[model samples]
Target chain A: MPLVDRVLLGPGPCNPYPEATLALAAPLLGHLDPEFLRILDETCDRLRTVWGTTNRRTLPLSGTGSIGMEAAFVNTVRPGTVVVVGVNGLFGVRMCEVASRYGAEVVRVDHEWGAPIDIRRMLDAHPKPDLVAAVHAETSTGVLSDIGGLAQAVHARDDNALVIADCVTSIAGMPLHIDEWGVDIAYAGTQKCLGVAPGLAPFTFSERAWARRVERPSTWYLDLGLIGDYVSGGAGGGRTYHHTAPTAMIASLHAGLGRILEEGLPAVHARHQAAGAQLQDGLAELGLKLFAADGHRLPQLTTVWVPEGVDSATIRTRLLRDFDIEIGAGAGEYATRVWRIGLMGPNATPARPALILAALRSLLG
Target chain B: MPLVDRVLLGPGPCNPYPEATLALAAPLLGHLDPEFLRILDETCDRLRTVWGTTNRRTLPLSGTGSIGMEAAFVNTVRPGTVVVVGVNGLFGVRMCEVASRYGAEVVRVDHEWGAPIDIRRMLDAHPKPDLVAAVHAETSTGVLSDIGGLAQAVHARDDNALVIADCVTSIAGMPLHIDEWGVDIAYAGTQKCLGVAPGLAPFTFSERAWARRVERPSTWYLDLGLIGDYVSGGAGGGRTYHHTAPTAMIASLHAGLGRILEEGLPAVHARHQAAGAQLQDGLAELGLKLFAADGHRLPQLTTVWVPEGVDSATIRTRLLRDFDIEIGAGAGEYATRVWRIGLMGPNATPARPALILAALRSLLG
Candidate 1:
């Protein structure tokens, strides 16, 4: 296939900062190299800042956010544990699936794909779950669940139960207070809001989550207890070699996080909100209906319903081929009924709003 | 910490191609983007060529090489499945640990660290284990096991028993004939001989192994059968969607593989061999004892026994602080007795060998 520049306005794989790319190209270092450790240390320090927590277990898992979700569940819920998952979108359902795979008794709180999670009902359903999990921003449907509300509800009933949140689509572009909201564990991917390349999943755990990790059944590779020790001067002090980390990806993340700091997290969040509103306005003017409920849509991603008689694939293909603009088709139940337009990271700009509007106008008309 | 220009002479995480790094910085693309899919297709094509296999199941697993090892066991060996693993190094021990966690009835073929795997003994002891696994190059002790010999022995007894080989330290730099040697399932990392950033694990399987994948019980995340379908043409025909892929990492890998192809695989292998010899000769002149037997040493990594009363950590620290050169301390049994010097990818240069020798001579003297 011939190479062509694309305007990414999808759920993820947003445009990256040039510096982040350059950081990736910097000289390779060993995973245990002192220099690389310094980079890891700095990256973790920045991660804590972005996550709004003082959790020492903050680090990047060397996989996508789905793996992050797996890491969170595998570490938190052992066999026969009771896991309550808020299932309003695809990611929440995935969390439930992962929890069940680990032999957890999963109780999913079902809601419509584009609707916000009902925290009260989730809390009322189960007597006491071993863990409560939800997605902060559901990438599949562009719905932002009330993470703070859910965390409160989960803690009010079962203080011992962990609260895990999938922040894959929210992290640098939204208000995520891991400490303030009493979340035990949270994870985010680089490509979405972090504006780095996708490969590393930045994750953090509160002290409560860390306490549970120590007694969890061992999964050799994904063992957080072992990984924490290895990272925190355990295997003979300094960086103990666990598995080889993706150095280039981490470097890119460091650069992306640096950009985040430079722009200031609040300003970045505001920009995402502004861009999201602009895109939503444009779509509405073009007779597109927002799939997500009002006041529940994620600022980073917007899911719009595919009008009747129009094939989502054809519109997406035409957008890519004719306009060089890429948007995401709905996943799961909404596969043919929605198109997710992302205004995330570098793509969350006024220029994207205008470009997407013009392309959709020509195509829909 | 101040950044310094240092030569990486360790077990993997060696120098990467500059172009590969730049490729990593390219605009982030969605995991299922058509353009990204084309790159994934190209990456699989290149990996197949390098792995010396025409099996349709060749692709990169999304995590580090350890994940590749886990995926291999998870997909092939279900609970109660008998798996015979050769334990001569850190990675081999890790393999046993991972397999055991998955409920595999793990049988061990133990050899002393720095010793080559005894194929005859392993086969005689196991007779007909469901799976026979071995590492091609034991990174911990720099020993190169007889992979071809082991694969033959495993297949001779039970043609159905899968032969799993860990090619992490010896993919492009050494001779690995997956097809000719009858290697059913083989996994490798990019940091070693591939001359790329570390994250993705390049893996391949024989037709027989692919069949085994179908019969395996379902796993939510590491289910290769499901992943293969999503990555290859899924139920959606040409459209494929599983987890979000690391797009930039794939791009870098593509460029790295391209560089390897441009140089010719044989030529790259020859360079590694020559560099290994040069390193060994220089170390011998410095009165350093080779950890592995001369003929069994891996071409990519040379483990040298530390001299009497010389602290390996102290020497390694000095090398890093004074010479800006990085090497590895012995892991497991050789923890304080040896240092692993790597000659991998672009780092397998005469300049690195000379610099490392000079630095060691200064420190040792």
Candidate 2:
């Protein structure tokens, strides 16, 4: 079979780092191999530094980004616990569903799509909430919420309330200091800003919030407390068998994280901001309107309203088939009315944005 | 870090096909990429062929073998349902734990370790069991139970009972006819016989078993009802987003399954049987005894009793460190009494058995 040479500039899963490719092909090892265990510990330390936390319970959840989000609720929110969640986009709505499925009394704070969430409205709900959750980067609308302000409000109302954020699309591309921002739990997917394939998700839990978890998590595959014990040296300094860790993906993430640290987080953030602005400007030049609110948009993912004369879905298909480029069409209410183009991780390069702009110009004409 | 050049003679994670490694490094596509959707369809087709059933509900689980097990129960066994589980080995014991965690009233049929389950006894005492589950190839004891007979008895007692099997260590290396054998649901891990890495798990559910599921599964991550719809081209012939599919691992499984079909399942089964006999005979000559019951033992994984004089754990450590070979040490009751050796997939070769025997001879003598 011939290899597909199309570029990935969609919502996520942009081309992984070249070193990640090497890590994927590295010789296989037993999950319990001493060498592999050492790799796990080292990887955890690096993830800690990247997550900007000293929390020891930090580790990668075994499944995808959604599972990592599920882990946050299943492990922390017990039955009958009141959770206040912001429902502005698809992701915020997903958080409510996940929390409610876990038996939480979800209190939703609604906002218009493509607009920033109102932290004050979310925090001023009746019946004091135990958890306040929102998406740090709402990928669906390309809007960024104020996590620090939400955290401050949650604590002011009740120091016991936990603040949770989904940093899946923002980690390496934005300024996110999890600890300083008071995010009790935050999960990031590897496919977004980390330049890795979409599998393992790095999620961390704060010391105070996790102390409330006395019962085992409902989902056996995603039992964070047990997985944490196994990943960090197990009982009696020996690693107990948890689920078989996805060795190839974990190794790939280790390699990807190393590249992230070497380039440095501050520099990576600057590159994303610059590249995002250039693409947004180019879209404006083509008479396309940006969908996200002006003052609080995610730089890494830009959503643009479909112009009146063009068939939006047709343009997306033509870009992929003819130009060998892929961009995302908006979902839910924004479907067929807007297009989401991502400039994340390696795709945030100045040259790549130019290529996308040129391809758009050629195809639109 | 230098790669370890050790031969995996342990119970699982045997050497994978070189082609699988190359496929892992293949250029990644977006989860919804047209090329990748084609790959997903192609992979589902190959999996259906390899699994020996025309069931359209078959696909690889994104997590490991254990999550596949979790999915089997979570999808079929509703809370408060009665399930009869056969507990002849560790894997069977685990089936009971997973079922009970999902709130099933699990009635366990106990058998001594290293023995096949008594099917008559298992079916005779049950208040109309909703599900009857057992291990096809128990990794811990190297015991192969009679899944066909168990399925027959399960249906004879009550046609409503779903016959579930754990074929984690037996899939491509054994005579597993899911439809003919009456298994409503069964899951297999990639690392064992499929010769892929240790991430993806391929499992299937019968139409009846899935139709019995009406309520949404508690786990958002392992919800088969939703994930199945997403994989089989969701409503209106467009795939709905469920979670980020593990593209690299899925691709590697696709490549590995292709190799399995090219070689044919019968040839793979025969190779494993022959190599297992060779390893058993060599161990017997070296003054050891096979632990599993005669005539019912698994050919890929052979559990052996440690000789009276030599320390079992010490020998395994030496085999790994000195001879670059890894073997399994028993847990629980057989902790220091047995060693489990594997000859599955790539490790089930003519020359590899000789190497393991030679390593044992040198280390022991």
CA shift of B14, model 1, Å? 0.4
Report the lDDT tens digits of candidate 1 across residue range A136-233. Answer: 99999899888998998788777988999999999998988999999999988988888887788899988888777735443566778777766676
| Cα lDDT computed for each candidate against the true fold | 0.85, 0.85
Task: Tell me each candidate's RMSD, in Å, in order.
Answer: 1.9, 1.5
Give me the candidate number with maximum DockQ: 2
> What is the per-candidate TM-score for chain B?
0.96, 0.97
lDDT (0-100) at residue A152 of candidate 1? 85
Residue-level lDDT of model 2, residues A1-365, one tens digit each, is 89886678888888888887789898887777777777778788888888888888778777778988888988877789999999889999989888887889999888999999897788677457888899989989999988888887778768888889998998888887788878899998999888898888898898887688747776777776678768986557766677778877888888988888899989988999999999999999988899999988787899999888889989999998888898998978788898999888888899878999999889787
* Model 1 lDDT per residue over B51-144, tens place: 9999888998888888889888888877888889999999999899888877899998889888899988888766668888999999898999
* lDDT of candidate 1 at residue A355, scale 0 to 100: 91
Q: How many backbone clashes does candidate 1 have?
A: 0
lDDT of 2 by residue, B152-239 (tens): 8777767999999898998888888888878899898999888888888898989988789746777777777679768996657777
